[model samples]
Target: MPYWRLSAYYFCYFAFVGAFSPYFTLYLKALSFSATDIAVLMSLMQVMRVLAPNLWGWLAEHLGVRLPIVRLSALMSLAGFSVFFFTDSFAGIFLGMALMSFFWSASLPLIESVTFAHLGTQGHRYGSVRAWGSVGFIVAVIGLGVVLDWLPIMAVLWGTASVLASIFLCSLAVPEAVRPLAHSASASLGDTLRRPEVKALLGACFLMSAAHGAFYVFFSILLVDHGYGKAMVGGLWALGVVSEILVFMFMPRLMRHYSLRAILLFAFSCAVLRFALTGWGVASAALVAFAQVLHGATFGAYHAAAIAAVNRWFAGRLQARGQALYGSLSFGAGGMLGGLVSGLGWETIGPAWTFTLGSGFALAGLLWLVWGWQPGLGEDGTDRPDGGGR
Candidate 1:
């Protein structure tokens, strides 16, 4: 498949998330639901993701037909999320979210494998392509927030469904990618797990991403409470992603000289600072905007590094599974836990305390990477590291 095709597809898919993340809880709040209920509902997606990626990745690895799985899941997701239009009852929303989450989580790990395959040795371009998804997110969130000010908030679901429908078409078109393979799957899984570096890499991702739990669940609401308008909400989000895009554009050069571990280390440091500042001001528009810029390093750089690490560690049959492990542990398990904790924590302890908790998570990740995982095996690109593939 063409790079633009895959990028556009991912962009559309994530745009749905952009719309959902900022406004979904607000929609529930409008219905008079409690904070706990809102958190549970918002967190259902992460819960579903915890195991779904591995299940789908296993299928793709064994069957070697990622596109088929991607398309099937996309259809299921569309059918699932579309139900939100008909009702606002807790049960209705619960079922709809459950179905969508179960299906939606299946796509990313598989897509990451496909993306790296297409990028070949220049896998650093992964960020530039992936950043388009961030762009799509910015466009959707900003546009939909304004739309909601004038329209029924539930319209977000219908609009998201349409974008998801486009993603389904792209799923059908994305070509199968070639992954390095060994014959037996069981041995590959075992070998990858036994690698010390794999363990450390997974640990680092989990810690850093756990810190984002607060931001995802409450950042917009926090802004709204501080007297920011809907348009400002979108502008702030767009600025963060704009910074992410800039980082992605220069990523290939960074990877050329710096180790993946080094990039990730820097991302973790930025995460610490970013969350600290976020937890501190929130009332100061300038401070909040500056914190958002750090998003480029925290999420953008961290993701590029993690994906590259997964690509190097997993050979052939283990490729999809490697990415799946990262998703399940980090975005899936970590995201769910973070959202659940923050959802209630935000209400109980307020923004500062909640964000402080997030900062701790990021700091834990930074320390692990700095002290435990050493990627100093090569400096001139002539040698392969012990925990990596060539």
Candidate 2:
């Protein structure tokens, strides 16, 4: 695999997200959207994510055409995003985000599976290549933050659009890896999902991620209201991504030292703690800044472990579908639930208590996996390499 090209692909792709995630709310506000309206619109993207990835995965698997699907989706995402520039009406924005997310999400799981397919058992090093994405995210967040401080929020969108275009160009540079054919060493999804352990792992991920809704939907507004300037907000967000990048730089080492079970447990525990601090620490920049660093464990480690778990749990043609399942269940359903609940709680209770609820969810997920998950050894059903890395 040409890792530099693949990593460049991720960096450009995620740079768009870093810009979009933090500023889209501001854009909605500029278009005269209410808080609830912004939340709903943002949640719609998560909805598409839930509905689209599995279908795309199934298609990619059956057709054996993962690269074309990725490229086409990137192109469509660029086109769909243009709709926002023409009209800011609720229906227009909703339709546009739906179209973009539906296609935008079609690519990642397949790309992940493809990258790992190219790497085989050496997959743990996925982090080293992937960490470039975190760097891109940091640069975008802080750069746009400063830009937004002086310019219109709409400029952020344009900036993000340029980045997405760059991602499309980079996608073209990623040479496709040969995927295993449908007939090769197959285990159907039915066979994979039938196992109690797989179900339990998915369940844990869904519950914990769903719990994180409060922070995602309202964290920025909460900080802004707390008197932090746009630059400070951007800096704090970059701090989190910086930590994530650092972890990715060392993720293979982390995997080598820990079991998948241990990694999951630690990641969720960090979420439990991070959200608790973030929810109530609005008055303390230091507290919030420190909490942001936990992104390393909460998101970085957890995601890497989850993908590795998916890689191990499914073989051959089922790989793409497996990664999709993990994304749909966790980021999809989990994201919507979190946004909805946070929107509700932000108006009624407050940011602090809403985040407390997020911690509860992570804690529940941690507990579930700690007790319910036990992998069936390996192909030999014996102790393996801890299923640690690529």
Candidate 3:
């Protein structure tokens, strides 16, 4: 099944995230960019996701292939990012981010579809495969943080470029997944979207991403503002991912014991607590660390279950678009809203209040799910009233 090859793609893909997410804001801040400017610039990644993935997904489906498109997207992402080396103006950086993100956003959703295609019936093992990406994230985040301590901030640009190049190289090794033939009698994509459960699921996913806006855009800044060193910041980021890795390793067992709905409910509940602790408890290192540990549930378990649900519901030729829609609505639309609102409020409402606001969003999602979602099955191959199985 080319497991390592698939894993390598995830590794390189998220390695770039590790480098970019934790440090890029620091880089912009070093360059004298305003908090608002940094927020807008960072939000470009999510903004492109709103449009790019569906476009690329449609193209891949049309061509009856995915790997070739993924390769092209990686190559273009590297090319687009290189623009940063030659320009520093706000407009120039904006253009570079937009161009890079448009193509960059295309890769993950398609690759997710590919991975599931390869997994077939053994899909519960997805977390074990996905755990490699978390490993890559820890490596890049910690390594770059340590390097940035001694080196100038330009080192961030160089480090990011190196990982982006690695992504293109890794893309060359991932073979395409075999496409299943469409049955003419099957239900259409419209029919699937029409289901009340699908609408509620997507809505909840959007809110979850929105709730994470402050952490992604300003968490490092918040720590640094509180006198935490850059290396320490990296370690904290790594700590969260370490817990995430543990969750991924055990996800197969988790899938066996709990339904996707239950996992998501638990995850949303943790998100509320995690963000609240992070916002109000930044002064206490132990409190912050405890909050980071909750990442195992908030992002790790939540994402594994959500994607699995999407895969189950979407089925057949709709797979690529289904994954795309999940990315677009959740990470793309939801993240963009979070970044923008957090940016606008970070200075006025302050970090604590901004994060408390995030907690509010998570609470909304938890309530929405509890009210809108119904139980399906238990992992024991029996229907249960509480929604128990994968």
Error of 1 at 354 (Å): 0.3
Report every candidate's CA lDDT: 0.82, 0.82, 0.90
The parts of candidate 2 lying over 4 Å away from their true place are 181-186, 375-390
Candidate 2 per-residue C-alpha lDDT over 328-365 given as tens digits, one digit per residue, 9 for 90 to 100 = 99988888888888777777887799999999999989
**For residues 1-390, could you state the per-residue lDDT of candidate 1 as single tens digits?**
378888888798778877888887777878888777887898888888888999999899778778888899999999998888888899999999999999999998888888878777766678878988998989888998888778886777777888889889888778877765453423457766765667777887877767998888778878887899877887888888888888888888988888888888899988889987888889899999999999999988888778777777675667788899999999888888888988888789988988988889999988887777766732222233233344
Tens digit per residue, CA lDDT, model 3, 1-390: 779999998999999999999999998888899889999999999999999999999998888889888999999998999999999999999999999999999999999999998987788889988999999999999999999999999999999999999999999999888775554554578876876667778999999999999999999999999999989999999999999999999999988888888999999999999999999999999999999999999999999989988877776788899999999999999999999889998989899999998899999999888877777722232332222222
Which wins on TM-score, candidate 2 or candidate 3? 3
Candidate 3 TM-score over all chains jointly: 0.96
**What TM-score goes with each of the models?**
0.94, 0.94, 0.96
Residue 45, candidate 2: Cα error in Å is 1.5
Best by lDDT: 3
Off by over 4 Å in 3: 377-390
- Structure candidate 3, residue pairs in collision: 259-388, 377-389
